[model samples]
Target: NSKPKDTQQSMCTPVCLGASGMVHVLLREELLLKEHILKTIILGQMLSLFICGTAVTSQYLAEQYQVNTPMFQSFINYSLLLLVYTTMLAFRTGSDSLWQILKQRWWKYIFLGLADVEANYMIVKAYQYTTLTSVQLLDCFGIPVLMALSWFILRARYRLIHFLAVAVCLLGVGTMVGADILAGRQDSEGSDVVIGDVLVLLGASLYAISNVSEEYIVKNLSRVEFLGMVGLFGTIISGLQLAIVEHREIMRIQWNWKIALLFTAFALCMFGLYSFMPVVIKVTSATSVNLGILTADLYSLFFGLFLFFYKFSGLYILSFVIIMVGFILYCSTPTRTAEPTALPQPGSTGLDNAALKLEENDSETPAITVQFTRGEAVVVSTD
Candidate 1:
């Protein structure tokens, strides 16, 4: 009787232990999956914030430069500062490198050159006419326009929540733009700032187009290679403007060491920023990319508030809150698919194999076999 009882107990032990092990493995896996999802989301948020900061800072610097272009030009001490930067970059990089990239990505360089030159010139011109706040407020239109373009042209499927969020942002834009218009009219000088606003709008549209175009460029080139090309092209475009618009002024300009230093700092800031923006987009999602731009707007507004004592009225402040809340509502909605996940074709192993390997016990038991026989037997067991 003791022998029979002992045998029964021994038989139950392995069964009970196996079941417990399976349960433990499943729990661990669930925890890991949850952790991974949380990490991805957090990273997305951080990337968005970082991108925004860079963008805001760049705009602020541009505003500063606009205030004193000739002075800014003098410090750089070139009749054509844009050309100077381009020439410097070209010389620094050497012809061989530039030619190699031109051969591979000529069209992309053209787009970058066009966008950069237009964006820079417009922003500078806008700042000379309208307030920084006005330029930024008008620039808000870019985000919505880009989103619409991405949806319609790029066929980027967005959640309904995203559209609602954008709608909220548009309302904010209307309020701010409306405020700027009223404020402009009340100004004693009464110069036509409308041109400045329109220029900014055009710049905004170009930016949207460039940002989308970059997605393709990144696939073909290294980050360094792409940015170098953009900077080079931007330099050329600016050089032409310097030649055409301010050549005589530039020739008569006297160098100011202090201003030159400031210009250098500003250029460095832009270089760092533009380089990082695309990289951030690559690491994160497009929504995050847009979020970065929005954040930058807030940052720029805050900087304006600090530097210029730019005050926001009750309506503008209210609009800001509503837009942000709408964005939060949209961004917080669960993504059905985060980044695109590649699926294996028929006859190839699927992600299930990878997912299974992530199991803790399976990791420890490297000899475990995943058996999938033709049309019938599918088993995962220790070999």
Candidate 2:
């Protein structure tokens, strides 16, 4: 009887231990998921606020001071980025040092910077041609474009919840548009609505490209690297463009303390947006960031009521609430990487296998795996 009891106890020990381990993993995952959701919401809202600040400042400059130098405004922001991030990058020495990264991937950052600079210019230029409400609403066109890029480039797989959430967010946008029409806030004084709308659409598309590239860089590499490269290249490109296009406008401006202050405010807001965007993008995604920032329009509307003396509408409040709901719904589900493995190229080492083992062993933390193939480092997975 004693021998039989001992045999039964031994048999149950492994099963009990395995069951307990599985439960612990599930509980940890649940906790991590909740933390991720909270961080995403907070960071996303912060970015939305920063962008709203930029929009308000830019609109005020265009309206009050006739400061229509989009290139110059963007150039200021890029210069600040160069002064901050690129300077910090210069001190680091490693494979990721500024010179090393430039040697390996200079062209990539150039395109990224160009896309970002143009996107900013187009959106700012739209302010001179369109209503504040229109810029806010039309800017959301980037969400779908961003999602498509993420699908193809990042291989990000989303669930049905994400699509549903997007629909809800768009529905909220429609509500806002209706409110704008009801309030007669769709048109601005001395503005070309058609041209503004077109510029916004183009800007949004470019923004999608920049944002997708940002996600890839911040997730696979580092935020500092992305900002540093963007700063370096953006400063160069925007400086050249500003000289060519906005020199006359710059000359015509009646310099004043107020105008100078507004420009400084705009630069600071834009710099904050650039600096903090990578944090949200790393935790959530480009698509989600775009979705979350849809509320920036609502923020703009709130300020517009006081600054532009626009009439208030209950629909705007409802629109804000709806967008928040959609953002929350989208974030409730986690987006996972799809088929993360990449094929080995010529002269491949065992690093890819080691990375796979690391990913498996470290399931709790988000891991970025780099596969070396043909003298290049390809990002195989990020989670």
Candidate 3:
């Protein structure tokens, strides 16, 4: 009778342990799935803040320290980003040269580099001829262009209400900037405002194109590797432009601790922007990312309370409320499914195996295998 009882207990032990393991795996997967969207949204917000901070600091540096050469500034930013990517690649692939992959993807990244450098240069230069209000107002136009591009180029889907929300956000931006302009924000003697506005428009359009293309590229490729390739090519492109255009200007800029600090700040923020951008793109559409960034001015406004001793006006408050409504309205929509419509070339593997996240339990006694797709991950037990 004692032998029979002992055998019964032994039989139940493995069954109970296996059931517990299965329950743990399912709970972990469910938690991760829920947190993924939250993580993406937070990253998008951080990207906007970084961009706003970068712009503010860059303006300060230019106004205070007389360091306004766009070419040299871009070159330094791209160079530092490239160095970081190079180091990451070296660590990621020990004993394997990066050139093996570089040879196949050079032109793809060169095009991205060109678009990125041009976008940065044009917007920075536009500030010389136009008021900040004009630049900010016109910059919001990129969202519409990005929306159109997403529909045509990337196959992004949206509802009529979503478009309306975007329009409302645009209206808010216009109101905020228009009030500033009416309050004498523009220089009466500035003669090139029209040209500056046009430049800003062109720059915004180019950025829209670049952002759409980038979203498409990252949807089919590794986010980190794509950024690394862009940084490498952008550095090359910027170096050429700097040598051609800003050779003398770069040599003449005053060098001091403040200038050095500003450069470091700009470089760090730019790097952060590039790194997190792909993640946001992966989690949401290019249009969503643009819409999310519509709040950058809002961030700057709040930041100004501390830094610039700014007093929020009625227009600012109204604009902030309107923008918030649009943001919440936009966020209520579900993410669209952007299938791989076209590859850069025939026989490209980028379209295949997109959502397979690997989970390996190498630290445990018996390893567990998990395969992740869009909705859920399934765990496989190894005996």
All candidates' lDDT scores?
Answer: 0.57, 0.88, 0.75
> In model 1, which regions exceed 4 Å deviation?
1-67, 70-100, 127-134, 152-155, 172-190, 251-254, 312-323, 333-383
**Candidate 1 residue-wise lDDT, 1-383, digit = tens:** 99999999999999999999999999998777666445544554454455444444444444554334532332232223334334444555554355666776688678776875676567656766666566767777677777766666445667888778777766765665565455452233215677778888997887777766665456444555556666666656666666677766545545577545555655554544555556765654455466434534544455656665666556657656666666555555544433343632325544333212223434555554454333233546764
User: What digit string (tens of lDDT, one per residue) describes model 3 on residues 165-263?
Assistant: 798888788877765565455445345999889989988988998898889878876676666777788888888888887899779878888888888
**Candidate 3 residue pairs in backbone clash:** none
For residues 33-149, write the lDDT of model 2, one tens digit per residue.
888888888888899899889888978988898878888988999999999999989999989899999999999999999999999889878877887677767888899899999
| TM-scores of all predicted structures | 0.60, 0.83, 0.73
Provide the lDDT at 354 for model 1: 28
* lDDT score for residue 270 of model 2: 91
For every model shown, the clashing-pair count is 1, 0, 0
Model number with the top lDDT: 2
Error of 3 at 51 (Å): 1.1
Q: What lDDT is reached at residue 364 by model 1?
A: 56
